[model samples]
Target: MQGLQQFFTNISQFFEFLVVYYSIILGFCALISVLVLGIIMFLRKTVLADRVFAKAASWGLLILCLFCGKLKLIFETKAGWYTLGRWDLLCAHRIVSIIYIVGIFIFAAYFIYRRRRLHKFVKGLDKATTCSFDNEIRKYPGTISPFCIGCIHPIIVIPEKLDVQNALIVIKHEETHIKLGHLWIIAGYDMVRCLLWPNVFLHIAAKYIKRDLEDVCDAVTMQMNGIDPFDYGESLLANAKEIMLSRKNMKCEEGFLFAWDDNYKVLNKRIHRILERNGYDRKVVLAGGILFIMALIASIFGIKCFSYKRNNPLDISGIYSMTKMDTVVQDTEEKIVTGYDGDYIYIDGAALKEAYPDAEIEEQPLFVFVGGYYKIPGVGGGGGWGEFSASDVKDGVFRIENHDDIDVWNWMIMWL
Candidate 1:
């Protein structure tokens, strides 16, 4: 148990060091997850998926919020046992929570405002070329999804004729986004992730997690539609032809959203697997659960081990007072030979002379000279080394221990 505890202690220390140096990257990873999930939710329209995503999101948000609140409190408060010590840990945590909550709210409000404006600016893009409901053929943009052209929420342009088909696949795909509330989450994620872009692991993790979310959504879509595997592939190819290669079709002005990018790569793989009759893998879910549990355990241990602790009175006095002294100037020194009976306070003769130049040295003992320095071990009546008697400081004279065996004071000096 001791060995394992030491090993874990080492690991926790290393992890804490990493956090201090790479906090921004960690933040980004969490933020990216939020964004991707939000995008998925908005595109799809289902409350159930949204609720699940929201719950996970809430936990992440809670953590970040707690951390932020702590930062603020730490900066605002004085550095001491009252602020940085274990007693203040909860207060610090509360501060972080406040910061995260405020930040998230501000970001959400801004995103909603922007989304609304965007919708008003461009709402006709999804309309098919024809207006008749019976024969409308809603065509997807070639290679890429629709792009926002105006400041308002940009409309997704689709041919009117394409609307004739139920568009179960597209609806499923988009519905996943809405139900998942991917947009809001992703927006929060991106904001945080951008601040920590240097961590490659975080970047990779963010990308992978987002892709996995998309895959999960795709699997659900296939399960719901029950379309022939071949037809789904055919639909993909058919829609691929309609997408324009122009930059205008890209989801982002500078980047492609639904092109043959990472998103599509995962999408393609998911579609193929679905067609092959591969159901959702329970192992993957199990593995994820196990990892989560391990992280939780590790986190709990780290908190317990690293969390602040109340300092004992004796230890606190010594530790806190050490900072106030500028120098240790010895006032006096006396050279005397003493029998090694484990009851003595051996003061350096030279150091004592240096501390007290005018002090007189009185000694009476079985003294012995060794290594050019006299040894005088002393044991007080009952008080310890730093302890003083009822008399004031001036009356208390420094005294060496009495040589005696079988005494408690004698045993204490032996250890010293």
Candidate 2:
């Protein structure tokens, strides 16, 4: 029970850090992805470049954000330089983190339930060996469009009434998704979505990532099979029509569906790209390349600008008498010792220093760093350091104005 409690405590702390610092990480990712997409779109003639670059930028930024989050967790420090000390912001962070964690649990349950249903459905269906590729192809009875499902052992499913040629194309497309490991990408994205449930920017980025994955699969399928782009577009349109008609009669369950051109606008964009496989002007490419480089540099600068730092340092050492305020009772006193050693300032012995070995310490001239929260007997404990000034000290008595951002008490030196 103690071990489990400790595990949860650690997890809670990590989530708190994420809630405090995620904005900076996500802002950088969003900025970089948007700039990269905009530059690619402007270049115009590079369809392949657009597809490749979009995939890279979207996935790359997400991975980078996850990496940054892990680093923050390991370091136990918020990444942004500025801490928004507003009470409302702190409350919001706590609330949002709670919601996100709950949402992940709910999503996981739903996902597992849906996957079980899908497996049962697959089991009942008649598996056929119609395609040249040795993949499990199952005919689904409903009017749903063809989609590839499952990550580890992917299976292609097609509607029963679809014609032979279109079925082949659908199978080919889904096989392309499976072959290129798009299902795993989508699974990874879903997990990210769950983690960043409150971030609208990340949701938008996810849509773009999904769209690029589909486009890449389409491009690869056409090239590998020597199929006509026009034909593929027609097949997609027919599939979309069938799916729309089917949806009128029944509701589709929520799960991973690698449906080709899930959104109409995205479908249109895919069709346009397929129809126009032209090259861009060299001058435009050159201009875009320069802009891309500039965006990269700007992204780096933005990350550094927002990153957190402990710049303030204070010289604090000695045994002091602490005072605590109470509404009904009188103030209370307790003896505490503070000592500075290397990067960490040990308080009331060295337990904190031992626990958080990599803790960043900064000394502000007038404030004594309490690290995180500290409990003063008969007083209260909060999550920030305490503040005091030179003038606050008189006759060997140092008044600790505010501890952990709370208006509390004073301390007098008892021993060195």
Candidate 3:
């Protein structure tokens, strides 16, 4: 049950990261689009181009603003970046985030498959000595053990020539890896790193996960045996002489455990790390995790802070008119206003005036945001839809910026 709970928690945290990361990605793309549109508009001098650039600019800037706000909230060290232990999952965007997460799982599967295949092929050729573990075990070409193969079922082929004393210690060490399931854990961490590519947090997470796995395995191996850890490590070095590709047994050792090259550096480091296992600070880990989560939460609220609020679709309901230019014109009446192109909404301005007789008839241009909200420039009232002119509108696509009617907002078209 505890394991199940942890699994769910991890999935939740991973999803949150994906959501925020995707938002960042989208925000970046929107920003670039806006900048490009802006440049195109400036160069073209067309009203349509200008309008498109303006809309794109507004969206891009809003996204960037939100990103900045979230960054502060999530990573604010001054406030002790804690949000009730909720791992900072960017609870902002929904659809894009789901897409990002699905992509991660696909990439991880591919990466694991490739790495596992390489490790398996390499392992088959990694023979430590002439003697085989069993009659079925073949003597291969290399002088290193191929114990670091699969995350699920790693087969560490030790040479059968070692004394029982040495053999027992080696078995205990390998047993630690199998029992703890460290390889699987490492493989998972590697996937996370690959998915998030340049993220510093993922890098830190990978480091700790790797280091802890090794340290824990070392402790487990020592606890299982009475042999001195140093002696077991020495035996590993004594019986092993680094050998590159052995021409004599090359074909026979194709799938055996052997060293790919004559480099004994990796084995040397393992021995050193085992000997120098004196420190593992829990506080550092706790602090790191806390910071990671805090940063994620800050990003969500920060986005909200930067977002521009527009009127809900429920507020305004009338035939709104939209027009592009004087040359191409069409109003909601079959109401071709003349010369305006693109699209327009024609609201019942006459009816609006009848509802509020004293209300001033004014022309307001409309702007629409991503979340179905519309903004009317220079309008200051609670419940009045004024007469809006195509000339007054700055953009080609005009929406009746004050309304909550979904039916009215459903019509979507391109101006060109």
Q: Report the C-alpha displacement of residue 231, candidate 2, in angstroms.
A: 2.7
List RMSD in Å for every model shown. Answer: 18.3, 11.9, 18.1
- Give per-residue lDDT, candidate 2, residue 352: 24
Q: Highest TM-score: which candidate?
A: 2
The Cα RMSD in angstroms, rounded to one decimal, for candidate 2 relative to the true structure is 11.9
Poorest 10 consecutive residues of model 3 by lDDT?
A: 407-416
TM-score of each: 0.40, 0.55, 0.40
Q: Higher TM-score: candidate 2 or 3? A: 2
User: Candidate 2 — which pairs collide?
Assistant: 45-280, 79-308, 80-308, 81-307, 81-308, 312-363, 313-363, 313-364, 314-363
Q: Give the total clashing residue pairs for model 2.
A: 9
TM-score of 2: 0.55
Residues 95-157 of candidate 3: C-alpha lDDT, one tens digit per residue: 655655566666678776878676656555544443323212223333445354465545555
Question: Which portions of model 2 miss their true places by more than 4 Å?
Answer: 1-57, 69-100, 132-134, 248-265, 278-318, 322-416
The top-ranked prediction according to lDDT is: 2
Residue 179, model 2: Cα distance from true site in angstroms: 1.8
Worst 10 residues of 1 by lDDT: 312-321
Flag the better candidate by lDDT, 1 or 3. Answer: 3
lDDT of 1 at 123: 49
lDDT of each: 0.39, 0.53, 0.43
